[model samples]
Target: MPKVSKWLRRWSLQLRWMFRYFLQWRLRHISDRQLVIGVSVLLGLGVGLVASFLLFTTRWISSLLAETPFGWLSSLYFIFPIIGILLVRTYVRFWFQGKFQKGMAYVLYGISKRQGNFEGYHRYAHVLTSAVTVGLGGSAGLEAPTVLTGASWGGFFARLFRLDSAYRVILAACGAAAGIAAVFGTPIGGVVFALEVLMANVHANFIVPLLISATASTLISRMLVEHELLTPREGLPAFDYVHLPFLVLLGILCGLIAAYFMWMSKQMTQWELREKKNGNRLFWEELFLLGALILFLPPLYGEGFEWLDAMINHHEMAYLQRSWWGHWLPAEWGIALLMFLVLMLKPLATWLTISSGGNGGAFAPTLFLGGTTGYLMAYVANHVLHFPVELPATMFTLIGMAATMAAYFHAPLTAIFMIAELSGGYHYFVPLMLITAIAYATKVIIQPVSAIQAAAQKIGAYLPADKDKAILNNISIKHVLERDCVPVPYEGSLRDLVDAIARSRRNIFPVVDKDGYLKGIILLDDVRSIIFKPALYDKVAIAELVHAPPAVVDIHESMEEVMEKFDATGAWNLPVVDEGRYRGFLSKSNILSVYRKRLRWQIEHFG
Candidate 1:
């Protein structure tokens, strides 16, 4: 029996290797464009199916834990959460080599800096950690973790197939889009999110891949989940000109709250480092503090999705229902008080979950805040102020989702499209546009840069997803370098330099030694007088007038970097060096021509 088992295992390994070799053979033979799109669709389906499994598993575990024999202990709500957090940190610290990378910011960094390469371990790392974090009643959700998984899939396929860095980046983005599409069942919104938040742009070449991936993933996710998480609206809002003023007010208020969330997130993110520097063990403190804190704020525990559902349905939510002081609190702590607490505490709890090493995304938190804010604001107006006109609170909740998301990420299209897909139609397009615009404008007016951009700037590695710049970053300096510059020897006389200069068509001259080592550059302007003087032409050695001009461009430098040198030195051209040898020269004009041609190709072909 033992010999038979070993034989079976050996055959399995051989079969797997044979299959992988077959894939590699095809990857090497097929056209890249067709192969990429085909693989991307398959990857999208894989991400969506995996996301659905995670969704089911987490929800099942969460429900089982909350409704089991010892369910009453969850009223205390702090014990299992402590166990959950401890287990998560312990696993990450010991098992995963102390690496914890799961969030939107991390994904953005991978796209902009690392060209979408990610470890296979991280795909499961984020899923497992987020499952335990949010499923075991941690104050977060799974959208961001799912994104990491999707991106990992994209990276895995690209790397396995040996795709170029640019293709890897695009597919990684497609993975992210597929994840969002499947997770939210919002394909258009997912595409926009990939463009607006992940890739940070909608390039012409990217639309086809993103659409294919998102659509495929959404189909798979919809099949697995069986229903939409955010069902579209059946009817339009009762919104008219009368609601405009209040809608504007809601937008401004949501912007302020968005700013507050960003500030709190930044502060909480740094709190651990600050505590460690002060000789405090923040890990244990974070666990204990979160445990103690959630015990008092029951609404802030878990993903808070159920609580949002109750609010949307206008059901009596449980704030002080299971509170430590449940007996003493008044019964009047109903929907209004619950609404107020959610608005106030959701942001803080989200920051706690994210900063304290719990894995999740801010999407759910931002949406919750927006919904509660709009719902509560309308509730107050109708009940407290006795406004002559009353509007539907649900409309406010839906539009507020977009407004807050836009303000938080400064991605208007993503927020708007996401809400539109959620609502099932564009019946409320006017209000959606107005609310998104006002919220985004207010946030931008107060803070010129968005939260993620601000964080990137702090790290001194800001990566803007501009099309022209992205292309320039990939292009090599050698491709456009001017090798036609005639070299002049450092020891040559003015007459000898003049003879060489006459053979060249440019103003700049590279001064090299007898052994072909670059000494410096001598501009024609600097030696214009000495070259024209008949008496001094032979008397002057070019070595005496060796003036180091602007910066030198390396053969390995990217065109993006070469342009920075041009801007810094205010020079039209610079010398290029290869291992201290004078390789060639690079002019700003020559580089721009190449850039324009590439840009045109990208637009025409990609679009």
Candidate 2:
């Protein structure tokens, strides 16, 4: 063992030395921009390979625990999920300070506020926990974890090279793009997903680097990933114009389903119930309940991609019907009913595990919901309405998956492109777009925000493009309000008031009583005429010069409300009242300065 350890360390040092020389040589010949793209390509390749490994490992774990030799234990495979959850909860509570982050929302938050600078633990936390969660039968996907891993790696690479904040954000985005591209094996879709869902800003310069990274990652993962998520099946249905109208209906149904899922997720946010009565001691109680649900509905286990494959491929469907669990069912109708029931329960199962703190993502669930919804819709039209060969459920299944993804994500372009690449052509482009647009429109009418956006909002962050709003929302009035304004005592004479104004640079001053309670404001503009009249200046008291402010800003109020106050009052500044006491003054200028700084940073890093 000692000899092996020594040999491994010596070999690692030699490889590092060689890689350093190679990078140095490459940097010397390339421009800074070219070098960045080159680094992005390599990063994409690495991310793709890692994503493929994660996909295969999780798939292998699922089969090893649930199939053949363990078929007798099929009833207990659900227990494996419990063990996985407990392990994850334990690791997070003890080793990771109890912060079991589960998705790419945190990465988006980081990009918005910290220029993509984030903690190191995030890179491995998702990989380990998500692998365990999906591997052991938790109803989630590896996409989110892979995205986080790639993003963290990109951040680390930027840090290693001491790259500027702007470069760091771009690189982090590149890594994320590569991960998605590799995982789904859809380069264009991956690039658009990164830009639309993760990046704070989209620009012309970003396109080339993202393209380079996404293409490289997809190619690399194609070589490493097994017959899993990224591997497109052969003999997928060709597009038939006769199915276009049905595709539209499928898209609308997807939108409605997305809305229902979002609403259900909100209802399942039962942290308030968990925190009732006492402290958050022995937290993870919900995991056990979620475990029981998976036990009853075996189809909820993992990402449900296997079911999706079966829905589109008849051979796979027939094979599923012949499995140990399937043999108990009556016949064709029995297996079909089981499939339908699984589809119906999938959303609820995902809600239970994920909302309860399981480490995973909704990428797979949304796809599953869409595919099943599409397939079921096709089944109804063909079997019930007797539509002959005019429609195939498999064709609608493909469109349905894209529609659901587009609606839930509110990313029609990404969905369309991803579906196109996944199915290996633009054959269904017309219907894909038609369905994606209708679904997105329906989603907008139902819920204005996507699940991803809503999740990030809990941390006071919004989607990447709304950086200014996110910053304003996260910072409180106490942090940015001007606290250095001069104050005049109500009892003070004009002489005293003038002395206070002369010494202070501010144009607005607050009038306070002896008890430090706010009375009114005295603006330099309002007092200018009085100050010039020598007779009134020395004779008048501060109280006579006082003018009531149009409005008062509360420290606890949101920046949006505060800005509205500024607009309604038409005042340059307003007094900040906290608990009915004058704390400071808030001005439009001060808020604008902070906003400009944040906006400038966002543009530099993401634009």
Candidate 3:
């Protein structure tokens, strides 16, 4: 065993040395921008293949279950989910130490708290877990897991190549763009999502690499996988100008529904957390609830993309095929009733799937609800209310999908372009723009932050959307601390102080006692009068010259608090102390300098 360990250490050292040599050679030959673009392309291709595999695997398993042997066992619908969730639970317990942090929330937390660093298991854990969960009708989407897998790879490569934090985060965002583009076949939408949701601030430099990555991923995914999940069928009608007013009304409704979506999801999460005790009792309860929901609501099965596709292509009876009471109601209003029920209950199924140890994302669920909302509105208005002209249920379904996505994610552009791209063109581009804008605006007024931001805040690692707070939050006080300020003994004479001043470059001097406790500060301006009279330098004590600073800065204070202190005291520099002992001084100028450097780095890091 010792010999094997020694051999492994030797090989690791040799590999690191070779990597460093290659990095040096590459640095001499290529610019940072060129290297980043090349890496982005590679990352896109790799993430594209992985995303395709996840999609393909989940769909294949789902298809196999929907066929003869498995399909015949409709009475035992819960069997697949039982096996899938059990496998995921076992996998997570042993492999991840029961710390299976999946989805967009985990990714956002990584960006905010870990400098875009992800655990090694993140690259494959979500893919393996989510495939089983969604494949066996666990009632969630694969997009979030795919995004996390892409982000993990991005962080992995950045660390492998020894890139800075700024570059690492940007590369991670690029990976996310690649994942989305590959999954949905929407390159531009993927780029917009990365910019709007993942990255707190969008710099000019992020555009090119994000575009390149998304394009590459889309191309690779197209070559490998010739399927799409949420795209509407062809031969759809063009947008009519007369439906603008109804579209606005639909937007308002979707905004309200978006709020409900977020609220219900939060309630479910809190309930699960509160009841996470009693020796697997809560798990069984959730499993039972999930089975009941899927048994009645067929659209809640798997990612629900197939059901969404059925709605898009006008397959109304698909919602009632396997349900107990679905056949009891009339065909006309039965579809509307089921659509409404599915819209209301989908969030619960998603919560159950995830809380019961299934791995998947809410991206698909949001779209499912949105499509349901749109179809319901158009169906009721045209058929029940007997509108003069037939309102296009197909177009409304597409619009609702975009509106709810915009509201929930706070990404209007992503929703607009994503729906347009999925529908195969920008034929309804103007309607998409108008409704998404309204929905986004309404949701923002109701809830200040998006669901992702709220999740990040819950973990105490939220990066604010405000540019100033975001920049200031990243600047640590330790990094900006000036430790070069000279200290003078409390009993020392002015002559000694003058001598100390001559040796030190800083004008502020911290006075300390025999026990190393902070006495006070001695500013150069306060002693300028006595310094010229050299005869009194020996007579006057250092304690006489020292006085309390306008404000004292604690070493542990945040940069924001330090700035507030600087402003309130109106002092150029303040003494920093810890537990009444003198440490150093903090200068307003130094803090500003560091802040500027960080802000500049955020904007122009590639250069």
Candidate 4:
């Protein structure tokens, strides 16, 4: 009967092991590239639907606010300036309080640190704040927050499914692409944006999933919005060959303007960092200040989100023509000056609005600034040089958009594709590429880091120089282990072993023979098991308590192999042996501690 019982136990163990092996095999199969692509597409579709709905809802609400009986709600323009102040206060306070906030910085951190495992709360806060700020006519856009939401969702899903780090990063990129595709209804732009800006790498491996997800998301968004995506006007007046020189000259000027925007963004972020260090205010206070600033900006307050809608639909010129300033101002001189001033001020305003805790993105502001710059430059070129370019202003506007974005973000491809998508594939590829390249080159010469990179560095989370190095190769048990010898003889008592473990701060001990050869391993569990059985504790040799055939490792083995062995054996410590003699025991606690310290150091120094 006892033999039969033993046989049953062995069979049960075998069945359990087989079941686990099958489960692991299934999981491995699911992590293949095909499955990842499918999942990304599905996620993109869902994101697109959500983004389109949000865009429509925000526009509807803005319209309703304008039409209210207190039509004076339109005059709430004065409130935006105050809101801007509050936004700054929020950023400052939160920064000082040590709460890791979400933004592009966090996205970068996730890619580098936790394998895109972002905290959900951080993302949620951004969404809530951005929505409220924009809803209240804060001079900002919702694109950043929307993208963050999608990325966070992707991160959460990847973690939940136990996907590898590489896949998680890819999924996060996919989610961001989906958000952009949905918002702009430009799948190509979305894909390129992920590669050029977020990943900063355009390898074939990333492009495949990015394109698939972006296309899917854009399709879904179109279905939800039930509106044709924006496209540039067709059959516009063409530039004469005589105007080519003027366009090239205009590109150079746009590059300079882009450099200014990038500089202003940096200064604003630096000021925020300085203020946080001084402890003058908190993040919520910045939110209040941002609210006040929103109240003061007339252009931001009167039309509100309607302006963005107009810009997207190419009806912005109509609104401008109807404005009070447009009616009184000289078409050439006054409007040109106003545009130049606004172009110079827009980046600063965006910085103030965002720093003060206003919920918004940089995308809308960049577009507005680019259009304004382009208009001003075109007017000057035509009036001063009598340039024969037809619709030179529109050409400059598109170029400005790409140039400014490329300069600020240091992402030329993303800037180019984004403009292309927004323009509905307008045939300005030659000019756009030229302007984007020049702007990128100019910015690179002027500033080594971008706004996102600078912000990330300030917040203690920066990307490593060599990110492609496998994490396994970088971390090793041998590197972390202490090179001291401590062991227990086979005859040692449980109490003795316990005392030694406490003093050594180790959970496992190597039981060695008199000749200093490793006999077996005695874990904390072994001590606990015999703790109440005092008679056995004293009488039983450590050998009797030890698990035989200690999991052993050579000093030169890779950490990856060590970890794999540790996992397979389910052991917290493994003995290090030279030949047949026990050298030391490597504890999991030590390995983990080293890894944590390294991570903390990376965050503090590099970030």
Model 1: lDDT equals 0.77
Clashes of 4: 52
Residue-by-residue lDDT tens digits, candidate 3, 263-309: 99888877666666534358878888898888777778888878878
Q: Worst ten-residue run, lDDT, model 2?
A: 314-323
Q: Choose 3 or 4, whichever is better by lDDT.
A: 3
Q: Which ten residues in a row have the lowest lDDT in candidate 3?
A: 68-77
Clashing residue pairs, backbone N/CA/C < 3 A, model 2: none
With candidate 4 superimposed using the best TM-score fit, by how many Å does residue 376's alpha carbon deviate from the native? Answer: 1.2
Ranking of models by TM-score: 3, 1, 2, 4
Q: List lDDT for all candidates, in order.
A: 0.77, 0.77, 0.83, 0.65
> Candidate 1 vs candidate 2: which has greater lDDT?
1
Model 1, residue 92: distance off in Å is 2.5
Q: What is candidate 2's CA lDDT for residue 170?
A: 77
**Candidate 1 local lDDT, 1-607, one digit each (tens):** 9999999999999998997897778767886666788888888889988888878777877877775332357544776676777778788889877776767766776776567888778677877888888887788778888887898889898887777777788889899898888877889988888888767655566688899999999898888775444552345455688889999999998898788778777777777678889998776676666776677667677876666555555553355565555546455435566567668777777776666677788888888778778878877777666688896777877777788989998888888888888766477788888888999998888887887677655643345366666677656776777788888998788887888788998888899999888899888888877776888888889889888868988887767678999999999889988888889888888888888887786666453
RMSD of each: 5.4, 5.8, 4.7, 12.7
Higher-TM-score candidate of 1 and 3: 3
> Can you write out model 2's per-residue Cα lDDT over 190-287, one digit (the tens) per residue?
89988888874676777888899888988888887653442345566778777777787788899998887778777756544556545774335666
Query: With candidate 3 superimposed using the best TM-score fit, by how many Å does residue 150's alpha carbon deviate from the native?
Result: 1.8
Cand. 3 TM to true fold: 0.83
Which residue pairs collide in model 3, if any?
none
Model 1 regions lying over 4 Å from their true place: 1-30, 68-76, 199-206, 226-242, 270-279, 325-335, 386-388, 423-426, 459-464, 476-562, 570-601
